[model samples]
Target: MAKVEQEAEVRYANADGLADALRGADALFVWDFLSTAVPDAWHAADRLRWLHIASAGVDPVLFPELRSSDVVLTNSRGVFDTPIAEYVLGVILAFAKDLMRSYDLQREKRWQHRETERLGGKRALVVGTGPIGRAIATTLRAAGMEVSGAGRSYRANDAHFGTVYPTDELSEHVGSADYVIAIAPLTEQTSGMFDRHVFRAMKNGARFINVGRGELAVTGDLIEALDTGQLGGAALDVFDNEPLPADSPLWTMPHVLVSPHMSGDVVGWRDSLVEIFVDNFTRWAAGEPLRNVVDKDLGYVPTGTSRV
Candidate 1:
C-alpha cells in the first residue's frame, strides 16, 4: 500500500501500542481483522477520519465508540465472496460423494465400496442474503440443487435469491431443506439464533453447515442434534470460541468436519485485501465516497450497494 501511496505516511503498531499509534493518525487500516484493539484505542483517535478493515465482516470492530463516531468505515466485502462460495461447494460435494470415508478406507488399505448420494434435486437453504450467501446459493443451484435464502426481511424477488423469507419463517423452512447453511452476520437478533428448537425442526437427515459467526450457533444444541441422529452430519468452519478448545467433543465426532475459520481465504488473500484498502484510500484522500462502506449499525455493507 505504501508503494502506491507514496505521499502518505504509514504507521504500524501491534495491539499493545495501538492506543499510542492512534494519537494523531488521519487514517487507519486495520489489517488484523480479528484484533479487538480498535475499541481500546478509539479514545486516542484525535485526527482519524477514515478506517478501513481488511475483512468483510466488521463485528470485531463494531464497538460502541466506533459505531457512534463520524469516522467512515469500509471493508473488503467483494474480496471474500467468491472464495467462500467455492469453499461451500467443495464441502457439499465432499459430503455427497462420501469423500472423507473413501479417504479413510484408502489410508487403511481396505477395499470398501459404498453408495454415495447424488447432488441433484437436493434442497439448500442459505441463511444470509449477503454477497457471500448469494454466491453460495448460485453455485449450489448450478450444481443441480434447489436453493432458497432467508434474510432479515422477506423479499419477493431478490437479484440473486429468487425468493427470500424473513427470519421469522426460518423454522418452517429448516424442516424441509436437505442442507441448512448458516452464513448470516452477528447481530443482536441473530446471536445464538440456532438452538435446540431450530435443530430439532430440521429434516431428520439434514446436514448443517456454518460459515457464519460462531456465536450464531449453540454448540451444545448442535452436539445433541448430531448425537441423537437428528442431523446426519455437520461441517463447521467457525466456532463460538476459536481454535475450538482442544477438549471440545467436536474434534472426535465421526460425522463432523472441523476446520479453522478460513472459508473466505485463498492464495493471495492478503494482497487482495491490500488492493481494496489502497483503492478505498485513494477515494478517501480525494474526498470521494469510498467503496464497501459499512452500515455500522447493521454490521454489514447494505445490499444493492455497488462495490468496486
Candidate 2:
C-alpha cells in the first residue's frame, strides 16, 4: 500500500475532518457512521469529485444537493455480512428453541421440560436478495432451514432461495412464512411499507424480524400485531426513533424484543471498514470503476441493513 501512498492525498477517518482535507484531496473517504457530516458540508461546493461513505446505507449522505451532483458515491457493502448473518442465525435458533422462555423458566426454579420447535425444517422468507440477504440464506440453509428470497424481480430458478418471488408478491409469501425477515432498503416504495395490512397477513404465531431501516415498519402497528395475536414474535434492532424514548411502552411488551440497533457491529468494525475503503480507494485513484456504487434514486438499493 505504501507504493501507492504518494498517489493518495488524504483519507478522512470520518466525516468530521473530511471537509478540511477536500481542498488538497483528489478523492475523499467519509466513514462517518454517526451522520453524513461532510455531504451536508460540501453540497454547494464543486471541489468534491467523489464521496465515499463507510456505512452500508447511504441515506445519511443522499442529501438533495449530493443526489443531483455528478459526484461518485459508494458504500461498505460486504464488510459486515458474516457477522450479521451470524446474528440472524442466532435469533432464528433462539426463537425456535424458545430460549427466552427457558431463561424465564429458570428464574422461576421450574424443572419442567417442554417440547420446542427446531429450525431444521422450518422455512424463512428473507426479503431483499442482496449480498447480506444471500449471506443470511446461505447461513440459514447450512443450519437446516429452508429459505425463500424476495426481491424486486424474479429470475428463473434461483438455487439459494427455495422460492423466488417478485417484490409485489411479498405479502402473499409473508402470510405463510414461519419467519419474515425484512432486510429491504429504505426507499420511496419501501418507506413505511410494513404496516397493519402487511402484519395482519402473516401466518398466526409467525416471527417478524426487522434488521432493516425503522422507516420500513410502523412501530406502534408492530405492537398492535403482537397484542392482537397476528404476529407470534418480533425482534427489532432498529426503530423509527433512535435511543428510543425512555418512556415508550415497547420496553415492556410481552412478546417483543428490542435491540438498540447493534446487530452488525463486532470487533474490528472500524479497521475492517478502513480496509474496504482502502481497496476501493486504490481503484478510484487508478481511474477504474468503483464497486458498490449507490444509486441515489434507489436510496441504498445495494444491500441489506447489517448494522441492524
Candidate 3:
C-alpha cells in the first residue's frame, strides 16, 4: 500500500464510509471482499473505472450494477492456490488415518489400535478446474491418489486431472470416488449444486471436503447425509453462514471437522494479497492489462487470463 499510495491518492472506507469514499473515485480496491456495502452505495460510484477484490471469489462484489458496467474487475487469484491445495491434502491424510479419533481416545485416556485407510490407491474427484483445482490435482496425484476433475465441461487427457467430467453430470460419476472435494467458485450455476441427490449418489462411507464457498453445498442436505451415514466424514472450512451459528448441529456432529474459513490463509497471506494488488495497480497506472481480470459473465477469472 505504501508503494501505491505514494503514487496515487488512496481513500480508505469501511462499510459506512464506502458511499462517501466512492463518490469521485476512479478505481476502488475492495480489501473486505465479504462486505455488501457496494450495491447499496452504487449511486455514488459516478467515475469508478476499475475494481479489484482481495479474494478469489467475486460473488459478494459482483452486484448487478457492477456486472453490467464497463469497470474492469480483478482478483487475487494465484496467491491462494498452492496454500489451499496443501491444506486439502493435509485433511485428506488426517481423515484416512483417523487422527481425530486418536485424539479423542487420547483425551479419554484410552488406548485402541485400528487399521487405517491408505491414500495411494484411493480415487478422488475434484470439482472445479481452475488454477486452484489444478494445483489440488497435482498435489493429490503426487501423494498417489487417482485424480479426476468435474468442471463446466468434459475433457480427456488433461495435464493435472486425468479426465474431467461435466459438473452437470457429477452425480453420475461420484460413486466411484473415495473422496469428493469441492473447490469451485460460487456462481448462479453453481450455488446449492451439492444437494441431497448428489450426496445420495456417492458411494456409502465416502468422505467429503469443501474449501470453496459455503453456498456451493446445501447445508441442510449435507447434515442429513452425514447423520444418515451416507458420508463417512466431512472436513469443512467454509459454511452456509460464517461463525456457523451456535445452534448448528455440525459443531457437535461425529466424524465432522469444522474450521473457520481460513483454508488458504497461511502466515504472511495478508502481505501476499497486498503485493498482488500493488502489482496490478502498477499495470493499471501504466495503461497495461491487469492480471487476474475476472470474466464477470462467468463470475471468475477465465482459463487463458494472466494467472500465476
Candidate 4:
C-alpha cells in the first residue's frame, strides 16, 4: 500500500493520522497502545474486514461497532511476553535483596552490610493465566520461586493443570504469598479487584508487581498500603492514566517505583509487530487458518495456544 498512490495516506503521525487513514481501509491495524476513545471509530469500522491490535491487550479498542462486526480481530500475543517476564523477575529480586535500599544508602556514603534475602523459596501467585502471566510464572519458577497461576477457568484438583488454579479464590492464595503479581486482564470482575481489602490481605512487606492494567490495583489503596507498611514496595509499569499525571503521589513515595510502562519496549518492536502481522496477514488473505484470532465472545481472551 505504501508504494502505490495511497503512499501519502499511509504515512502516519500518530493515532489521529492513522485513524484518518482507517476511514477507507478495508482492514485496520490498531497499533496505538494508548487507550483511544475515538467516538467515530464506527465510521471506518463499517468498512473494516479485520482489526489487529499491536498491543497484547484489546479492551481499550473494543467498541460497540467493532465488537459487533464480522471482521476478524487479533492481537500481538507473544511479542512482549519475554521482555516483560524478565523485568518482573528483576523487580522481584531487587525487592527481595533490598537492592533499592542499598543504592539509597550508598548514595549517602553510608556503609551497611545487611544480610538480605533471595528470591528463591518465595511463593508467587500470578493472578492471570494470560501469556504475560504464564511467562512471569515460568521465569519466576526458574528463579526458584514456588509459582502458581490462576485464571477464570483453572481447577485445583485437575492434576494435569499443575501450579495453576482458578481465579475465583485469588484472596486465598494471594494473602499468604511472599509476592503477589497481577497480570490480570481488565474486565468487569478485575477493574477494582485490588482495593483496600485486597491490599490488607497481602502479607506485610510483601512486594506487589503490576505490569498489567493500572486500574487492577486501586490507587488510593496502594498508597495506603505502602504508607502503612502493609506492602514492602511496588514496581508499577502501567497506570490508570498515561505519563501518570506529573503530580501523582505515587511518584514521590520512597517505597514505590513509578515507571513509564516501558517493559515491552525492544529495539525491534515495530519490526516485530509488522513481522507478526505479515505472517498472519498472508494466511488471512489466502483464506487459510488465521493465527492469534481473538475469542471475541469472551472479550479478548488469550488462550496462548498458537494456531501456528
Candidate 5:
C-alpha cells in the first residue's frame, strides 16, 4: 500500500464504492473479478488508461464499453494456471479411485470394498489449449494418462498434448476419452458447449471435469446426463448460479462433486494474484509493455503476447 501510494494516488473501491473511484483514475486494479459493478461504474472512468483484472478470466471486467475503449486490459493469466491444473488432476484422481463414494461409506460406518478405475493409460481430452489447459495436459501425461487437446484449431505434435483437435469437432471424438475436462475461456462460441449432445456423445461411464466458467456447460443438460448415466460422474468447480442454490439437485447427486469455484485457489493464492498486478503496475509506471494483455475480441490473452 505504501509503495503504491508513493507511485500515485490510490482510490480504493469495492463493488458498491466505485461511485467516484474511477473518476480521473489513470489505472484500475480489479481484484473482485466476478463483480459486475464495473459496467455500472464504467461511465465514471473518464481518464482511465489501463485496467487490470486479478484473475485469468477477464470476461467479468471486459464489458462492452471497456472493450471499445482505448484502455489496455490485462489479466493475471499465469498466476492460476498451475494451481488450476493441479486441481483438475486432483478431481481426475478422485473420480478414478471413487474416493467420494468411499468417503460417503465411511460416514455411514459401512465396510464395503469396490473396484476402482486406474488412472494410468486412461485417455483424457482437455478442452482449451491455453496455458492452464497445457499445464493440465502435461501433468496428466506425467501421471501416465494419454492426454489430447481440443482448441480453436487442430495441431500436430503439441509439446503437452500430442494431437490437438478442433473444439468444433468435439462431439465426433469426445467418446474416446475416459475423462473430458473443460477449461476454456468463456466466449460466445464456447457458452453452453457441453450440452446434452456433447454429454450424450461421451462414452458411457466416462467422467467430466469443469474448472472453467460456469456458463460453459448447460446445467440442466449436465444434470440430465448424470441422471441418465450418460456420464459416470462430474466434478464441477463452477456453476451457472454461484452459491449454487440450495435446492439444486446437483447437491445430492451421488456422482456429482460440487465445489465453490475454488479450483485455482490454493494457499497464499491472493499473494500470487497481487504479485502479477504489482509487477504489471511497475511496468505501467515505467511505460513498459504490460504482461497478460488481453485480446478483447478473442476474450483471452493470446499466446506469445506476454512480454518479459
Candidate 6:
C-alpha cells in the first residue's frame, strides 16, 4: 500500500463479500491464489481493468469470463523458480541418502547403517522446459546428474537446455530415467498426461516427483505403480485434491512422501509476492505494460519473455 498510497484506494474483501466488492473496482489483487471466488465475482467487475494473481500458475483464475475479457492478467513467476529448484534438489538428496530411513532408525534407537545411492551418473527426465523446470535441471546437473528436458516442442542444443525433446518423446525416456520429475503447467494437453501407460513405462525402482499441478497425473495409477513395485517411490507435493483427504492411502505409504503443495515456498515468500504485485500495480496504474503478463490463451507467460 505504501508504494501506491498516493494513487489508488485499496479495498478488502473475503469470499463472502467478493462479488459486491468487485463492483466499480478498477484493479484487483488476488492475494488468495487458491480462491475460486474471483470467477464467481467477475460478473460484478464493472470497472475491472487489471487482475493480478500472486502465484506462478494461473489455472485457478483462468475462468471463461476472464479468459474472454480485456482485463490484463499477470502472475508472480520468477520469484519461486530458484526456491522450488532448491527444494527439488533437497528431496533428491534426501532420497539418495535414505535420510528418511535414518530418521526412522534414530526414533527406534537402532544404530543400523546402510549403503546409499550415488547421485552422480544418475539420469533425470524433467518434464516442462519453463524457467522452473530449467532451474531444476540446472541445479540437478550441478549436483552431477545427467538431465534431459521435455517440452511442448523439441529444441536441439539450446543454451540453457542442451536438448529439449518434444512431449511425444517423453515415454521413450521414462524407462531410462532414475528420476522422473513433472513441473509442467496445468493445461488441456497436460491434464492426466501421466497415467497407466506412462507409469508402466517407468524403469523399475525409479522414483517419481511432481512439483507441478496434481491433475497432470492419475493418483490411482501412481498408487498401483508403487504397490506393484514398478516405481521405487514417489515424492508428491501436489495432488488431485488439496489437503489430500485424511483417509488417502498415500499418507501412510512407507515409500511415499507427501507434502502440502509447498515446494516453491521459502522464508519471506509472502513478502516477495507482495513486492511483485506492488511493482506490477504501479505499471498498471500508469497505463504501462506490466511484468509477468500471461498469455491468456496459452495459460502461462510465453517463453523467452521478460518476467519482471
In the range 1-308, model 5's lDDT, one tens digit per residue, is 56678999998998787958889999999888888889999999999999999888887877789899999999888877888889988989998898888898999999999999889999999998889998899899999999999999999999889999998888998999999999999988899999999999999999999999889999999999999998999999999888899999999997899999999999998988888888888889999989989999999989767832
lDDT of 2: 0.77
Candidate 1 vs. true structure, TM-score: 0.97
Residue ranges of candidate 5 with Cα displaced over 4 Å? none
Across residues 1-308, which tens digit of lDDT does each residue of candidate 1 receive? 77645968778899999999999999999999888899888889998988999988889998888888898889888888888989888898899999999999999999988999999999999999888999998999999999989999988877777889887667877888899889998888788888999999999989999998888889999999999999999999999998899999999997899999999889999999999988887877788888988999898899888585
Models 1 onward score TM values of 0.97, 0.89, 0.99, 0.90, 0.98, 0.97
Q: Please provide, for model 3 over 77-174, each residue's C-alpha lDDT reduced to its tens digit, 9 standing for 90 to 100.
A: 98889999999999999999999999999999999999999999899999999999999999999999999999999999988898999999989999
Q: After superposition, which runs of candidate 4 have C-alpha atoms over 4 Å from their true positions?
A: 1-13, 18-20, 35-39, 157-161, 304-308
lDDT by residue for model 6 over 23-123, one digit each (tens)?
Answer: 99998999888888998888899999889998888889999999999998889988889988998998888899999999999999999979999999999
After superposition, candidate 1 runs with Cα above 4 Å error: 3-5
Which RMSD does model 1 reach against the true structure?
1.2
List, residue by residue over 124-221, the lDDT tens digit for candidate 2: 88887777787888988899988888887775567677677887766776876898888887777777778888888889999888887777888788
Model 2: lDDT of residue 3: 33
**Best-matching candidate per TM-score:** 3
Q: Which stretches of candidate 3 lie over 4 Å from their true place?
A: none
Ten-residue segment with the worst summed lDDT in candidate 5?
Answer: 299-308
Q: Worst ten-residue run, lDDT, model 3?
A: 299-308
lDDT for residue 14 in candidate 6, whole number 0-100: 98
- In order, candidate lDDTs are 0.89, 0.77, 0.93, 0.76, 0.90, 0.88
Query: Mind giving the per-residue lDDT tens digits that candidate 4 earns over 211-232?
Result: 9889888998998999999998
Give the distance in Å from residue 198's predicted Cα in candidate 1 to where it truly belongs: 0.8
Best prediction by lDDT: 3
Clashing pairs in 5: none
Once superposed on the true structure, which residue ranges of model 2 sit more than 4 Å away at CA? 1-7, 11-25, 34-36, 301-308
Q: After superposition, how far is residue 236 of candidate 6 from its true place, in Å?
A: 0.8
